[model samples]
Target chain A: MLGLSITQWLFGTLSLMAIMFALMMVFTRSPVNSALYLIMTFFCIAGHYLLLNAQFLAVVQIVVYAGAIMVLFLYIIMLMNLNADEEPRKHVLTRAIAAIIGGMLLFVMIGALRGAEQLQIVQGGASQIGLVKNLGKVLFTEFLFPFEIASVLLLAALVGAIMIGKRDTNINTK
Target chain B: MLNGIPINYYIMLSAVLFIIGAVGVMARRNAIIIFMCIELMLNAVNLMLVAFSTLHNDANGQVFVFFIMAVAAAEVAVGLAILSMVYRNFKSIDIDLLSRLKN
Candidate 1:
């Protein structure tokens, strides 16, 4: 050990904050509050990306998740016109069944994890460097086709979404 | 890497986060919150990808993470638009209320 207590302290505090917000997001009753908590979770994940030396990903994580996607979420929430009075309350039987199903899922996950092959995680510091440029190179060179395909898919999805969202004036005219 | 923290620690942290997100999805009835949980899950996967990249000592994981970010962005745009449409018609974003398309 190099006696860098500050590093571990920082990482541990950040991880704790991330976990807290994640749990809050799950339990928060209001969708808007849940969305806000999820943003906090995204910010902490960006911090993790930075810790892992992926500075570019850290920036993209903020720009994409925290900034863009979260804003979109807030916009939808605003458009939905939700209030405390009208939200449907789940029946007691349904809630009980849900809890049972969730417990079973947890049990399965624990069993699967217990038997899973352990990845031999190498220990110690990495000498790796040059994150952005290297990632860009691989993205453009090796993953070029997949990237282009994703773009095409996005375009198609955009057209489909717009068509679905468009209002039909002919019905009103009739 | 500090104090010999193994790659599994990072992966495990993300895996736990992913499970938390999944539970959120199951418990939440709101569409936007469910979508947020999905994004959380995606971010967790991205965390594991970067960790694995460092483990195998390759930059490909970072590249994949970037592509995922792009796809996620696209998905959010399209998803929010649909949500807004559903809201315009139903005046609500509850998953239970979105039964117009169920048939």
Candidate 2:
């Protein structure tokens, strides 16, 4: 058993699955397949959120990321009819450089966090802070301004998307 | 304490995920795929934020994650719209072919 509890086991499994799916998402040639793999990765992340007891965020992660965003991705892919064979591969040298860059970044990050385990995290015992009631209270009070701004941002994005996606009738007339 | 798991574990996991996303962004030529990679990077950041939030027992970090999700949604909407328009004009979504602006 290696002295590991069930929670540790779950964490290990979820992390591995998440990494594997993310790799598959990047490596897959088909856009649809890539999207699907990314969805699986999102689910794994949601599981991580639940493990952390961020229940509201866990549900939101699934609803927003896995549900809305990925659906939009699939819709765009289907609309464009992008096929696996049609996508032109990047040069081999470019891919190798990218991999090397990523590896270096990972190495630097790990190096920076060499003593992170010794850093003490103050544990507020059995905190109910992850619940929606607590989060909403904080959100509406201290963060009220940002919350209102986010709404305006969403509105602007909606209008901009419509403007961009609509066919320009004036071009044909000219 | 998240079942006695160290915060470093979450940190490492997110770091790896973020690196994967960064590599995907740099290596892929497809604009849509690049956009997805950006989303992946954002998710990695979100995970880190939530983990820290839990560590400190503060709802503020989770609130930031919520705001991030909002911004990400808006960004995706506008980005995909632009990408679709680009496809309409160029008949392709390959970033290499869209190099007319470089000249």
Candidate 3:
């Protein structure tokens, strides 16, 4: 029998991976390495979705975030030929302010989460309800327009990227 | 004896991740790295959403996470484009150097 406690442990492990990889992505000096680590972080987040019983979402997260978006990032990073030379050092004051703000955000999120425990608990498994079909139902019936608009935005982004990434022959000629 | 964690644990972890990302954003000079840090914060928020969704046994939060992921994809695409443009003009992705916007 699958126990709730066991499931929680599984999620806890994946969460640890996610957090560590995220920190790596942020703290790394090399943008190329950071981008690759971010891909790992995305995969861990997908694992969390699977733990939550959102099978469709888990797959989608992998497909969209890990698969497509990350490859896009890698492509751009490589295409730009951005190596160690491009990054510059920041001032101490900026770093200090960032640390202070980061500490505050951490405190607030923890406090809010503690408060959530006092709130009423919900009891039911949407995971058991056939996630993919149900999600499609909602997308088509209720969130159809939003779904279409999302595609539209993606389309615009695609065009815009091509436009920007296109080699500037005009400038080269001059 | 390994399953002692509650939903709160996950939430706390997410909070820490978010904070780290925030620090990277404010402190890091590289525009691309700062953007990656923003993505980290967003993923951290997604982690919290999925955790709560699991705790409550509700799929709505998970659904919201899906939307958030979509939006994040869009944002990254556009933002990276802008950054590349900044690079094209300035030759460096340093945030502090892109001061005048026109220059």
Candidate 4:
């Protein structure tokens, strides 16, 4: 008589898809395919955000992550003209160590999580903090300083990107 | 029997994602793939933050996620530029081949 609700079903499906896509991103031979898989993972994460009622964050995740960042990655991948089998084979030892380290990190984190107290379902009435209007209000008012700083940071990043990416024929000639 | 799912599931899922990202970063030779793995790790953290924010009935976590997204965007721009430059110079983007600085 028990069945998963719409929220549960969505969460389960999205999380599974996210995990699968992430793994594929790691294991796929082609960088372009990996970039595409990353985009899929990002979309799944955005769905998770929506389930949590962080609609604004979800939209931004899609716009910034799936939209802007991923396009940049794909563009770079294309520009480089990378082939599927181009990467030199990693040493077996390196692969083993990486897997072991990853497993240990997961083990430790899960162990720590096991000791935490059981969390009760949040009883707060339908939260509206996720709405763009309310989030914009708080972002501008309470978090105004950080907001300005973020803009400055973006500008700096833009300048830095331009500097790094600009052609320098002198270096090649020398 | 899934009525109200426990918060632990989300935490566990995030942890799994983080681990996958870590492994990808370590195992991948291409710098761009490493960068994508890093992005994956960041997304895992963002998911955890949002889940906690919902649990605590606060919007601050969402705000922080916003900031994180901005930073991530900036990082991707600069990082990919650098990666492309490295590719241009070495004719490959493999991280192992980036040891010319040691010479």
Score chain B of each candidate by TM-score. Answer: 0.93, 0.96, 0.91, 0.94
Superposition error at A107 for model 4 (Å): 1.1
Interface RMSD of 4: 2.2
lDDT of 4 by residue, B39-81 (tens): 9999999999988888887889899999999999888888988
Model 1 lDDT per residue over B1-103, tens place: 4443456567657777787777767766778778888988898899889878766778877888888888888788788878877777777778887776778
| Segments of candidate 4 deviating more than 4 angstroms | A121-125, A172-174
Best by lDDT: 2
Q: How would you encode candidate 3's per-residue C-alpha lDDT over A96-137 as one tens digit per residue?
A: 878888888777766666656543222225345228887777
**Span of 10 residues, lowest total lDDT, candidate 2 chain A:** A116-125
Can you tell me the CAPRI class of model 4? medium
Candidate 2 lDDT score at position A48 = 90
| lDDT (tens digit, per residue) of candidate 3 on B9-77 | 666777787888888888888887888888888888887887777666666776678788888887888
Q: Tell me the lDDT of model 4 at A48.
A: 89
Output the better candidate (2/4) by lDDT.
2
Off by over 4 Å in 3: A1-4, A112-126, A166-174, B1-5, B101-103
Quote the true-contact fraction of every model.
Answer: 0.44, 0.67, 0.54, 0.73
Question: Could you give candidate 2's per-residue lDDT for residues B1-103 as a string of tens digits?
Answer: 3346788988999999999999999999999999999999999999999889888888989999999999999999999999999999999999999888799
Q: Best by TM-score, which number?
A: 2
Q: What interface RMSD does each of the candidate structures achieve?
A: 3.0, 2.1, 3.5, 2.2
lDDT of 4 at A17: 99
For model 2 the interface RMSD, in Å, equals 2.1
What local lDDT score does residue B24 receive in model 3, on the 0 to 100 scale?
A: 85
Name the TM-score of candidate 4: 0.94
Lowest lDDT sum, 10 consecutive residues, model 4 chain A, at A118-127
